[model samples]
Target: MGKTYCHPAMKQLKDQQTRYAPKERRLEQVERAEQLLGEIDRTKRYPYDYLCFRITGFRPDNWSALMIEGDEARRDLRQFVEDLSATVRQPVEQATEPVLTVDEVSKKYNVSTRTVTRWRRQGLVARRFVIDGRAKVGFLESSLQRFVAEHRGQVERGSRFRQLTDAEKDEIIRRARRMSQFRSGEVGLIEIARRIARKMARSTETVRLTLKAYDREHPDRAIFGPSTTPLDDDAKAQIYLRHRMGVSAENLAVEYGRTRSSVYRIINEVRAQRILETKLEFIGNESFDDSKAKSVIMAPLPAPADGKAPRRPKAPKGLPPYLASLYEVPLLDREQEAHLFRQMNYLKSEAVKLREKLDPAKAKTAALDKIDELQEQALAVKNQIIRANLRLVVSIAKRHVGPMNNFFELVSDGNMSLIRAVEKFDYARGNKFSTYASWAIMKNYARTIPEENYRRDRFVTGHEEMFEAAADNRIDEHEYESALKRMQEAIRGMLDRLDDREKMIITSRFGLGGASERTLEQLGRELGITKERVRQIESRGVDKLRRIAGEQKLDLPML
Candidate 1:
């Protein structure tokens, strides 16, 4: 229901009296209202008749009274009056202490601290005061009770409003109209609102709010115009065109006297309209789903007579599909190259240490096997660097791909030189990898052309002599094999001098003791000890073997 007021001063007086009323008087009203509700419930009489009879008691009815028929309706009225009376009495009980802290108010109302702050902003809260020299907000007991009573029905009904009667609203609008007339004059909005507020015996803020609401209701005829004046078709077109020509939103907003967001919104609307127009034109007489456009485009080509997938494009000469695919591998940045370079150095150092225990006679297989594993890991890091800088190789190779050298051959040779550069390139030296790799790649390409020319020439004119010269320089391959076998056997004999555990440690650490060489950590796991402990054992074992070999005067390879 809308608000009803008999008179503003009378209403104000009633509110003040309710706040300062005696506790006994408020309680007596609550009790009397309850008694009337009970009588209506027991007798099944109309609410208005009951109220009139109770007010007149034994007196006869003088005029026809408003009839409120229904138990539920009468009960609701009783409950509302009872709640209001109880609320009024509560403030009297707490008359000695009327202040409340923010926390206290939040707790009583079962709301968050933020909600309490918002209530204060919305003028729903009681007056604020300072406590303990700190600025704080406090809702009086009377104010809180009043708030609760006002909201009780609203809580159940959903729709709610701060009590403002139609007459009061009309008065506010009339004042707002007066302000609007004076708004374009020398009097500013603030001064006009203040003058109207004083005349109406209200706050300037209230007048300001009422004026703003009135303006919104009549936007075109508003005193200050609309909050965001919309763009016309021509203005929208200008925004779209200027934005496309690289004009910034800030400049456009300033030029048009609008916000940046407003200008951007207009531009977006124009673009969307244009897109829709284009799509409509395209769909004339026939239609297709834009979402399925990708699938439509990717409709497969017809299969061949052999019933197989189409063959891939030819890879570059001497480059298999797998190797060529590596070209697509992600390139490493400076940090990545530096990190990989560190790992490579560590692996290299470990490999050097393992090589010392390599038995040339019996441990050749084990030693070479482990060394190959370490080399493979080091090669992985090298390949990453190579993949990243491969573009450099291609650019250099492209310049030399002509008469004497094929593009593929130059690329392959350039790649090999690139790998060498990755291994030696020191990022700490502060030189870019591209600069170093470029010179190495170019030098390789230069040598490649001359070598190709020489090979072609030798094939054409001196094939027989070249074969004779190669044959004359050849050594007995079996003699080299036999000597290596003897050296491995001698090394095995030296290994026999150490104990079984020491021998095993030496073999595994160098790959001679196991199928593959093991890192100290790997050996420790297998031996059920820590890596540091494994290192100590290996060191003691190696020292013992070195001494035995020295005493024997056996020309053992450096261990």
Candidate 2:
């Protein structure tokens, strides 16, 4: 028999058909087989013998089976074997290789097609083959598995992929609200954004947008106005105290919950207003006092409403009419005033030169030599100047009394200026000695007033303290000198008791006579002894000195 060939389902159908066939149908089957053979030859284009041989086991008796089965059975059997091979190959190939298409892999990995191409280019995936002129790409199963496992952590935490937790979303919402409020100065937007971003580990801008959305949804609770409010009087006072006490603005801002700019504005405004009010009040009071004094000096005078002229009193007993007329006279022409000013300036220059020629130090010595001859004249001149400028010192001291005291010091300073004015006096200058002295005294007084009061008390002003410290240093120096002299005397007395060799060695070694220390060798050579012997003798002499110092209850001098 020819090799039996059958599809499992087809074979079962054929068996059922054969079992139903009877002997009377055998002749009909034979006739059908011959007809089928004829049809197979026409359709399949095969010779009858070849087709019959393929279908049946090459036997003359099996010719009818061959003709009946023919190409239909052969075609079915070939299809079944092909399908079985495909089924076996498919799972085997799938086990070793990836079944996913490039597009599918990209979607699975959450990456772009370009990214997948890049991975293939970088050898991250296996090279592909071309089928039917179309590029067919694939990856090894192990490679895909490893790639997925390696990047799983990155995928889970990727910015584009990861979802924010409830807390993070809430924080972002809060920040957005703050940003919207911040535009109106209602909230500290920067701080709020910063806090939210830190908690969420996100960018500040992200938090800012979130806050803005939150603020839109809940607009009523938005903060507004300035970040800070104006300080109360007590707060102002506290700030002033801190400023006066020299607290830094940075530190004050931290303590007061304000910015440096706010604190500075308050301090400066308060100080400036206080100073302006004080200066204005002082000027007003001074003007009032001046008017009162003028009224007392020239009583029963009519007050001038326009401030054009001084209301003069009736002439005093000692004044001549011409002198009074001169006092009241104003230059009628500008030329006359100019001429007088020129002459005054010339006289003033000459007077300054003459004043420079007189030396107070030399004058004091010269005055002693001719004391009896000039004493009376000097006393008379001094009395006249004092009588002329009665309140000169008081006026000079008043100008310096703003924030300082020490009236007597101001007076002594004025006395120096008065002496200089007297020496340089030029009556022809059209300016009196009192007027010149007034300028000099005022200049010196104003110059001495410090810009800042470093010392709290007038008695302990910086300059005074400096002088006191210098005087104290001088006293300390005197005490030190006294002690040093006593120590030298004691050392000298101790030296007298030493032997001549020891004395010379000790004196040279310690540099007692002059200001140079001698080496042991130099001292030893000078004394005609070995250096070692000199050292020994020097050591013994030191011990003896210590003993003598102990017996005399004296402290040995330090080296």
Candidate 3:
């Protein structure tokens, strides 16, 4: 299900027979594609309209500009040229179109006969016929030219093929690391690295590894973001999440300021990644392959109809907000559990089947897109299963809590185990998923939670895991809190430099006296002015305070 990590840049030509065939010289089209591939500068961005004009000679209205990587655009275009020749090139009169045997094409491309076999299965037509001496099994030369137009591995490789200098690696890594600060949280770090790889005419892996090596060397400064990075996985994952929630790529494109195709590209990339990453190990059943398996086993089970998943349940009386919110999703019934498990496994099976048709070397966009759709469907089904079972993690974690085990930490580990069990559970065996998940959660808690820490009694969430591998910052809680105390103590006197209104605004804006910081609007409401005016006064007060701090040598948080 993991798709080829190709940026979407190709648009299928309309009734493209003429362009692909081209006045009895289809071979020339492949040559044209090769030329176009060479002309591509991977670092640059091309708009949809420009790409259409360059590849298909027709510019449409309102095309996206600079939305995808130059290398991916070239890759997709070259693939399309080859696919066109492979799928559409008919086997004409044998005498008219010169024959090229599988061996001959393989030798020419330095590929194995196996590769050509895959090609033939995809679309290239071949025939067994008598040739000069006896008989030869070969496809039309025109077909070979059209279909075998890809030149991927040599150029699109990583460090294995390319030799980048230290300076070159450093530049790419530095730019990439800087981008990772904000972009790695979700925006397009992978896409950006690919662009640099193309721009430098290096393999994409070269850039990827350069960034990775830098990250390994500087673990704290890694480009993938802070450990709490799930808030934004990637633009592709974000787009997929929204799309699963019923947002169309076209509308999302508008919302995200990308071309519709780019949005779809992100979604497909994420979906394919998820499917490929997931291990769909379902227990096989004879009924699974039955002709009526889908209709019967996959029949709509008794559960919420579309749009009927449980809403937020009201907070239970006399409970803390955190614990109460845990009850938002209702538990699933037996049939619903069976339905979700079957749907999840079935969707994965179908995706894996479709994945057989997707070759990373030459992915068919339409097929990949279909795989994405299936992946999304599977994910939606899997999520329903997860939601119905999340509370179960918390329930079991409570029993296993110990002196060393923080409840939240145990719950986090148990939740991960639950997700894994869901993916690994076999619905065909007719066992309840809850039982399997419960076992998984318990198994995870059986491990010892760390018994020692600098601050063993610190009441906090599970973020301490990051500190285990953190660089030698060495500053413990007391030292950090002591530093904060000093800053707070110093800030009290810094307010004296400001006038009455200025002092009030500064104090209120910063929550200096322990009341929650007031917003510009809130300050304006109290002071009888517009929020913008309040902002102006706050700005002046901050400037005066900064100057006063500089004059008095005060070290505060703002300073």
Give me the runs in candidate 1 sitting further than 4 Å from their true place: 1-327, 357-373, 454-559
Off by over 4 Å in 3: 1-283, 303-314, 318-322, 402-404, 450-559
Give the winner by TM-score.
3
lDDT of 2 by residue, 170-197 (tens): 7576555556555543335445666666
lDDT of each: 0.55, 0.48, 0.62
**Global Cα RMSD, each model:** 33.8, 49.3, 21.8
Question: Candidate 1 lDDT (Cα, whole model)?
Answer: 0.55
Worst 10-residue lDDT window, candidate 2: 279-288
Instruction: Rank the models by TM-score, top first.
Output: 3, 1, 2
TM-scores of the candidates are 0.23, 0.19, 0.34
Which lDDT tens digits does candidate 1 get at residues 1-559?
Answer: 1011222222222233344456565554444544454445433545344554452233224324434444533334343343334345343223345667778876665555655554543233333244564434455665556556656542222222234567876787776666667554445445666777677655555566676677779877666453356668998899878776546665676467555566766765665454324311000111122444434322322244455543444436644353576556545555455555555554554455555554432333345545545655556556666777776777787788654455666778888998778767766665667888998888777776888788887775531221112222255877666755665665677778788878788877665523465667567767777668989988998788677767866555444
Per-residue lDDT of 395 in model 3 = 86
- What is the overall TM-score of model 2 with all chains considered together? 0.19
Which candidate tops lDDT? 3
